[model samples]
Target chain A: MSQCLHQVAGPVWNLGRLNHVAIAVPDLGKAAAFYKDVLGAQVSEAVPLPEHGVSVVFVDLGNTKVELLHPLGKDSPIAGFLQKNKAGGMHHICIEVDNIKAALMDLKNKRIRSLSDEAKIGAHGKPVVFLHPKDCGGVLVELEEA
Target chain B: MSQCLHQVAGPVWNLGRLNHVAIAVPDLGKAAAFYKDVLGAQVSEAVPLPEHGVSVVFVDLGNTKVELLHPLGKDSPIAGFLQKNKAGGMHHICIEVDNIKAALMDLKNKRIRSLSDEAKIGAHGKPVVFLHPKDCGGVLVELEEA
Candidate 1:
């Protein structure tokens, strides 16, 4: 039944690999060290994205990544999250999509609300949009163009 | 200097791929549908683990998986997390390790406390140990034997 429906109305977009799981941390250096020295994963140097209001360090896990994020400015997006979760916590999960616009449109038609009306350049310099957590089982999901 | 130190101290264990990210959900069916019907991902049937006190549905994302967990029995570990986050949320991330015992020993030596003194048989039937969230930047990290 599903296959027949798919053949008839063909899916608009395709979901790709799991990009990275974002973690918000109060201490960026300690978090980076935890992945690099403690867990012994290859970690990238902390890259400050002032415009994005966060400093990110990518912890390479071979197949995927763990992005450690820290507040970079006064009005950082993750500031309130850090305030609520004092010690910091898992922030969001980014998943790759073949077509952001198609995915957004399809998701919108499915009543899945995006945080923004259109895709924006994400930290990875790819077009991305965050789906509302309320509609995603309280999980902030980022769909990035693959 | 780090390379020289690595040669001198040789890391005890190696961190492998990220196995899966676990999300605790209040409603198993709805969460499963969100990933399957909404996001169009390959989802598995919910498997009840009475001993583990949770029902799990694997959302295969190609590279890794999203384990959607719902409280099973009365003593479900995720029951409290669900109570706190009514809409459901990301619970823990499981990362594979080359040597579980060695990883636990090394982490213990580094003052990285595990929730239990020893590794236990996890839901996937692998030896797994959960590290203290406080020590892991408030992220509950599960180290599974690869």
Candidate 2:
């Protein structure tokens, strides 16, 4: 419906600003070693987000990032993804945008459901919104304002 | 024995380069609308890779590419992925690397089974290798060269 309105459609994903794709790994250090020694990506930091129940390591890939996550407990999101997914990998892809709210509204206009109805503060205290995997084709996609 | 070498110790996947990440959709034009018209990503081309048993539209997402695949025939790869995975969508995440041969060698050295022992060319004349879901969790990852 809004596509007819063109730029009037809420906000684009700011596609060009997409930063990194996150993968859920069973062993964070192991994945870090693989991505670093093998892929040569840079590792920035590893902070345990207890509220989320996991330890995360951020690997920088220039314009994008690869987040390797290890579940802290049995009921963690990464654990659920690993059990259903198997060999532990990609959790969600994060795309960077200047305006998170506008971008979220755009996804909504496209009939895509957000994991969070509104943009919320993420790990780094940055505003973020997660698109439902149902709408993203089996991948949890996070939109963060750059 | 060489998990340190190949990295992942459990299985061997003679992955070549990332072939492309396939995104299944009920409507190609609508999906393309979100990826292209909305996100500003380009729809480079659309073609049917009958050998792989799916029709695909390549949506270029800068560093990566989003492939919108429609089932050409019933019970095709796209259809099967949809059937098993259902609503939530990551079909498979492909990784592009050098030396598929050496990669497989490292896998075998670690007693890991592969979906296939070899590589086959597909779509854009690039070689592809698939890892058995049993070994790679539920995800069917494709490996090729960058």
Candidate 3:
């Protein structure tokens, strides 16, 4: 089915590298320790993103990264997710796109819904939009402009 | 804490790249279509691994891959996971390691538990071991030999 679609017309925007995998952790310090001290990965200090309602720590794997997220304020976005997933879990995967607008337009045409109509400035200060998990095989996917 | 640990002694094994983020999907075809057609990713055909009790479709995002897994046999390891995550969800993240034996030994010394005492041949025909989710901040982690 995808072969036929690919043969007809090429993709509007190129899907680049996987930016990072976000993990919402109940204990940010413990999670950071596990990745750094235990796994021997280069881990960054927790940066509080108050506007985003979470504190993030980047676990750099040299190729890609794992973003460790923890609830920051009262309206932390990951708070509810932590409630359901007590110990912490893989929250979302962010993939880079050559053009965010083109990707969103193409996805919308294909009946793929985005969480928002327009791309917003993400943690990296890049234009990003999240796709609806229900339409994305039940996995929360974030598309960031590369 | 990690800085202090690093100052004391170097890690036993090196942590390599982020291998793949595994997603357990209820419908393999739909998930594959979403990645190949909708997202315009280079996706491989579903390969059934009866021994592994799952069918895997690799969505290549250039730098890293997203592994879509579906149960192949009755006693599939992902069966219980899919039952809980009815709409499907992120299952585990596999990270490449330079030495599996040394990594296991080091993790054991740190009181981090693996699912098994010994590493087993994984889907990629490489030595792999799954770390206990409880000890790894509730996220199932697979360490694959690079």
Candidate 4:
């Protein structure tokens, strides 16, 4: 394994609740149908996000939501993922935080890398920033201002 | 983008809550420390599961838990993962369900494959069955009898 004992004081506030689990799917319609027709899940209509270059739909689970993501444009991040993983896969996970700016400062102080320099409006219309997966044990984590 | 329109006659019972998100880590102690000391989260003692060839610790997030897994033996399933990833990564996700047998049968009926034919005792000391990653959009899924 690897070795690292970097220490920093715990979060100034609670890390926050898990907002959603995002899944990258090549075909949005087919994936939505599987959740709806097979699992009997109530899925939302697909919303296109031109800024993020992705289209998304939320699957309601009462306590949480599953965000289905699909590439929207040529330079979409999901497009590269789909090229590598032909079928699709779990993309990233989002967690809600009370203050995005504070969280970003905390992460920066801890020497953590953020994918973006600043938080951008996400699918929920909330400011969100993505943490580098390399720092998160290979799991891409998103912190949404809640 | 793949095509799938498999329809099932809805589930007889609601799928239970998402129990935990499992992450495969190279160093269990270091990973646990990150969540505890960095995130200020409560973490459980590391527990070894000889049968599964892994040692695990649960980081409590109040509403949910993050299960950190490390290789326990040479033949451990996580060993190969660590060899390739070096820094570890998100391995699988477990979802709680009302009945394991019913869920298995439902999956079988849908032509979905399970990793094992029978449920095995998981770290939570509950009967758990793994679903094939290929069938779950490249994400390994575990269904625990709740």
The most accurate candidate by lDDT is: 1
Listed in order, each prediction's TM-score against the native is 0.93, 0.75, 0.93, 0.87
lDDT (10s digit) by residue, model 2, range A1-146: 44759647444445654466567776677667655654445776678898777898887644455567788865886787788755675577676677887777776676789977899887767888888776665567787776
Report the Cα lDDT for residue B38, model 2. 52
Best by DockQ: 1
Clashing pairs in 1: none
- Which docking band does candidate 4 fall into? acceptable
Give the per-residue Cα lDDT of candidate 1 at B110.
77
Model 1, range B1-146, lDDT digits (tens) per residue?
A: 76456444755688999999999998899999999998999999999999899999999999999999999989899999999999999999999998998898788777899999999999999999999999999999999998
Residue by residue across B42-143, what tens digits does model 3's lDDT show?
A: 999999999999999999998999999999988999999999999999999999999998888778767899999999999999999999999998899999
Per-residue lDDT tens digits for candidate 4, residues A1-146, read 11132223433545777788888888889888766764556899999988889999888766677788999977997888788878777888787788888788777766779998888888778999999887777778888988
lDDT of 4 by residue, B49-107 (tens): 88888999987765677789999977998888789878887777777778787677677
1 versus 3: better TM-score goes to: 1
Model 4, C-alpha of B52: deviation from truth (Å): 2.1
TM-score of chain B of each: 0.92, 0.76, 0.92, 0.88
Worst 10 residues of 1 chain A by lDDT: A2-11
Give the runs in model 1 whose Cα sits over 4 Å from its true position.
A1-11, B1-11
Error of 3 at A98 (Å): 0.9
Model 2, DockQ value? 0.25
Candidate 1 or 4, higher lDDT?
A: 1
Summarize candidate 1's per-residue lDDT along A12-129 as a digit string, tens digits. Answer: 7899999999999999999999999999999999999998999999999999999999999899999999999999999999999999988987787778999999999999899999
Give residue A70's lDDT in candidate 3 (0 to 100): 98
